[model samples]
Target: MNTKIAIIGAGPAGLMLSHLLAQKGIDSVILERRSQKDIEETVRAGVLEQGTIELMRSVGLEERMNQIGYKHEGINIQFNQERHRIDFPSLTNQEVMVYPQHEVIKDLLNARQKEGASIYFEVEEVELFDIESKTPSVEFTQYGERYSIHCDYIAGCDGFHGPSRKAIPSEQLKEYEHTYDHGWLGILAETAPASEELVYTHHPNGFALLSTRTPTLQRFYLQVDRTDHIDNWSDERIWEELRTRVDLGNGPELQEGRITSKNIVAMKSYVCETMHYGSLFLAGDAAHIVPPTGAKGMNLAMSDVQVLAQGLIEYYQDNREELLNSYEAIALRRVWKAQRFSAFMTKLLHPEQGASPYELRLQESELDYLVSSKAAQQSLAENYTGLPIEWEKGKKDTILS
Candidate 1:
C-alpha cells in the first residue's frame, strides 16, 4: 500500500487527523490494533472544550454532538461545606459540551467511513521503518497476512503505550514525568445526574467529582490510594464516599442506581520534549499526557493533530516547510500550559497523604481565593473552555491559501 501519510492509531487524534487531511484532498491510511467496536465503546473523558467543539463543527462532524451533547455554562466547586460556581460563559463567552468521549469516536468513525477513509483495524505487530528517511513506511500483520504502507510521512497517534513513541530513540527525546501517589476511582451509573452541571468537590477525606454523561447516565470519581482496586470498592461503598465528599448541604440529592462500570485510573503528567522524529510526527497521547483534572486529554490531542494537519497541508500545497519545522514549538506551548493547569488543579483538590494541618489550611485558602476573586474565576474559565489555538494563522494560511 502507498499513501501520502500513514496514521497509527484510530483514536480521536488519528481519526480527526485523517478526516482533516481528507478535507485538504490528502490521502492517508490508518493502522489500528483494536477492533472498530472496541474503539467506539471505550469510555474516557467527556468534557469538550470550546476549541474542540469548533474543530468538529468545522469538519461537519457536529450533527449528533450538537443534538445530544449537553451544554454547561459553569461548574460548581465545593469545599468547607460551601459551594461556589465558576461561570464559564459569563467569564469567557464560551461553554463546555458534556458528551462522552466514545460518542465523539463514533461520530469521527462514521465520517471517516463516509469519506471512504482507509483504516485497518485489529492490526498486529505494527512497526515503523526509516522514519528519518524521506519516505517512511509502516509494516504490520493482519490475520496472518503481511502488509506494508509506504508513505511520505508517518503520524504517531498510537497513544502513550503504543509503538510509535517507543520507535523514537530515547537519546533524541527527553521525557518528563510526575506520578501522583493517588488515583481516581471512576464509576458510571444508570441514573439521572444529581445536579444540572458538574460539581468538583474538595473534602478532607479526598476529592470527588459529579458529572453527567447523558440524561439518564452519570459519571462519578473519587480520589483513592494509588494501589486501590475495583474489588475494594463495592457499589454501596462508592456511593457513600461520593455522597459524603460532595455534600453540598441541602443541595441536590444524589440518586442511586446500578453501576454499569468501574475502574481506577492512576494520575500522572507526562510530556516528551520533542513531538517529532524525522518524517514521523507524534500527536495526542503519543506526545503528551495531562492529569484528567483539567479534562484536557482529548482536547489536547485534537489540538496537536489540528496543528499537524495544517503543517502537512502547507507542505503538500506550497512546498513550504516553515509550518512543519515549527510544529514542535507551536504544539509544545499549548501542551505545557495545559500541563501546568492540570497539575495545579490536581494539587489543589487532592490532599497529600500525610499533609499537615498548615498544608490543608493553605489548600482551603486557595479555594477561597478562587471563589472570592473574579479575576481568578475568569482565569479558570478561560483555561477550562480552552485558550484560542495559537496556530490559527497556519490553519487559515493552508486551508484558505
Candidate 2:
C-alpha cells in the first residue's frame, strides 16, 4: 500500500520512469488499466532518438532493441512527385531506430520484473487523492477488490485520457491544443518496405508516409478526412491511395501486401504548460502530444520521463529541490519545439482543407526551396534527427526554478 513513488499507467513514460528510478535505488509501484498482454500487443510506431537509444543502453534495457531494432541514417521528403533525401549523419551526426513503442514497454516491463519490481495491471476506476500534498495516494480496483497505494509522490504518466490529468484542479492548470482537420489512416502489412529509409510524401491527394517495422512488415499511413471511418477504406482502396499519394519517379514502386491491422488517428498538437502540479508530475502524453508527422511521439515521451527521473534522482539523492521545481519549465521548452516541427511538417505536407491555387503553390515552393538549399536541408535533418536534450546527469548552476 505504501511506496516511494506511485506511477499510473504502464506505458513507456511510466515504465521508463520506474526503470530509471530503480537504477538509482528508488522504489516505485506501477498501476495500469490495461492487461500486460494488451499493452505488449498493441503496435505503435517508435522512431528512437539518439538520446533515447543511448538512455535505454545506459539503464541495461537495450539487449532486445539493439538486436531487433532497425536503424536509419536519414529520411526522404517528396513533393510535387519529386524526392529529396536528407542525410542525417552528415548533417546532424545522429540516427534513429525504428523500434515500436510496444517493444520499449516489453523491455522496460521485463527489466522491472527481473529486478523484482511490482506493476499492477488491469486496475480499474483509478483515482488520485491529495495530489497537491506530500502524502499522495492512488485508489483503484483489481479482480473485484478495492485497493489503494500510498506514496511519497505520484506520477501522472497515465496519458491524456487517464485520471492523473483529470485529477488536477482545472483552476491551476493551463492547456493549449490544436486539432487538425485531417488524420492518418495507418496500416501494418506483411510486405517489403517501399524504401530503405522512411518516405514522407506530399501529394495533391494527401500526405502519406512509408515506414518499416520489420524485415517483412511495413507500416504506412495516409492523410484522410478526420470524419472518415475505417469502414470507408478496404484493403484494396487503402493500397491504391497509398500508391497514389506516394508515387514518385525517384523512389521504389509501391508494394502491396496483406494488411494485418488498420486504424485512423487524428492529428493534434497539445501542451500542458503545467507538467508539475504539486506532488503529481505529468510526463509523456499526459503533458504534451505531437502529431506523428515528425515522428516525435515516442521519442518525446522518452525524453520527458528522462528529465523527470533526473529531477527525482536529484531530490532523493542530494535533497535538492531546484530540479523538481523547474520540471515544468524545462520540459515545456522541448515540448514546444517539437510541436513547432510537427506543425511545420503537417502544414507543409497536408494541403489546406480549402485553399486558393496560389496558397497550394506556396506549399510546393517551400518544398522546392528546402530541397535546393543545404541550409534548409540541414535544419530539417537536425530537427528530424532530434534537437539537443540534456543528456548529462546531475544539476546545473544555471537552471532556475
Candidate 3:
C-alpha cells in the first residue's frame, strides 16, 4: 500500500493519531474540511485529565502545555450557599490541567509541520470505500480534483459528523443515544480567572462552572434550558444571571468581556458497537461520543488513539492482529466508564426544574456526602484526576505516545 493510514479530521484525535503513527515510522495523511484559522477560532473542551497530560508528555507535546497550562489541585462544589473543596491530589495523588482544545490543535499543527507530514487543510468529500472488503481506501477531494489514497488501514478519527459511521451498514450498526433537557452556554473572557480551581455551583436558577485557559484568560459556562436561546441573554443579562448562580460569598469578581461567543450545546451520549470492519478502523468521536460534563471528550479521544497506535505498532512489527481485534472492546470499556461518570457529574450538579422536593433534597444529600465522606471524595478525585490508563503491558502513569 502507498499509504499506511488516512485520518479524517484535523482535531485532536486525527492529529494525535498522525503524530503517534509517525513515531512508529508509519506514514499517514490527515484530511480536515475546516481551515486552520477556523479551528483555532472555535472554543471548546478546556480541562485535561492527568492521564491526558501524561500521554502528551510521552508523545513530545507537553513542554509548552506544562509551561502555560493551568494546574488545578481540586474542584469546589457550591450548594445551598456552602462551598466544599474536594482536594484531588489529596485523594487521588494527581492533578488536572486547564488547557483548551484550540491550543492543543495549535501545538499539533506546529509539530506536524516540523515533521513535514501530510495534513491537508480545507479538504472535502472524504469517503470510505470497500470498508468491509479486504482492501479499504479513502476517497477525498482537494483543489477541485478527486483523489483516492490506498492505505494498509484507515483510522476514522473524524468526529461525530464524519463518514465513518455512515460507511457502516445501517442494519449492522445499533446506535444508543441519550439527550438531556439542559444545555450549556459558554463564554470566554480576557479577565483573570475568578478562582484557582474550577467551581461547579448548583443553584436554583441553573448550573455554572468557573474555569480557566491561561493565567489571564477565563472560561466559564452557564447551564440553561435546552430551549433557551443565546439571544435571550445580553451581556449584562448574562452577568446578572452568573452573579445569581455563582454567588460563592467571596468568589472572585467576574469581569465581563465581549461575550466573545455564545451557543447552546446539548448534552448527549452515543456509541456504535464493533468499531471496525475489514481494514477500516474507527477511533474517537467517530466511534463513540460522550457528554462533556466530565471533560472526557478530548481525553477519551486521546485514549482511543493510544490503543489504536499500540495495536498498529504491534501489527507492523510482528504481524499481530490480536490487539487489533480487541481494540473495540478495550476502548469501549473505558468509554462507557467515562460516559457514566460524565452523566453522573452532570445530573449531580445541574438542577432540574419541577423536580420533586424529595429529589432536590437527595441532590443536596449527595453533595453533602461527597464533601463529608473520604470515600466519596476519593472516588471523585480519582476520576477527576483520571485513573491510571489501562495499557497492554500494564497500567502506566502516562499514556501519551
TM-score of 1: 0.97
Total clashes for model 3: 1
Ten consecutive residues with minimal summed lDDT in candidate 1? 392-401
Give the Cα RMSD of candidate 2. Answer: 2.6
| Clashes by residue pair, model 3 | 55-400
lDDT of each: 0.90, 0.88, 0.82
Quote each prediction's TM-score: 0.97, 0.96, 0.95
Q: At residue 347, what lDDT does model 3 achieve?
A: 86
Q: 311 in model 1: Cα distance from truth in Å?
A: 0.5
What would the per-residue lDDT of candidate 2 be over residues 1-401, giving only the tens digit for each residue?
Answer: 88999999899999999998998899999999999999999988999988788888888888999899988998999987877888898888889898999999999989899999989999999999998888889999999999999998899898889898898899988999999999999999999878999999988888899999998999999999998999999999998888888877665598888999999988888998888988999998988889999889888887788778888999999999887787777777778889999999899889878878999999999989988998998998888877766433343211121
Error of 1 at 159 (Å): 0.7
User: At residue 218, what lDDT does model 1 achieve?
Assistant: 86
Give the winner by lDDT.
Answer: 1
lDDT of 3 by residue, 137-220 (tens): 888888898888888788888888888778888887867888888889888777777778888998888889888776666778
For lDDT, candidate 1 versus 2, the one ahead is 1
Instruction: Name the regions of candidate 2 deviating beyond 4 angstroms.
Output: 249-252, 390-401
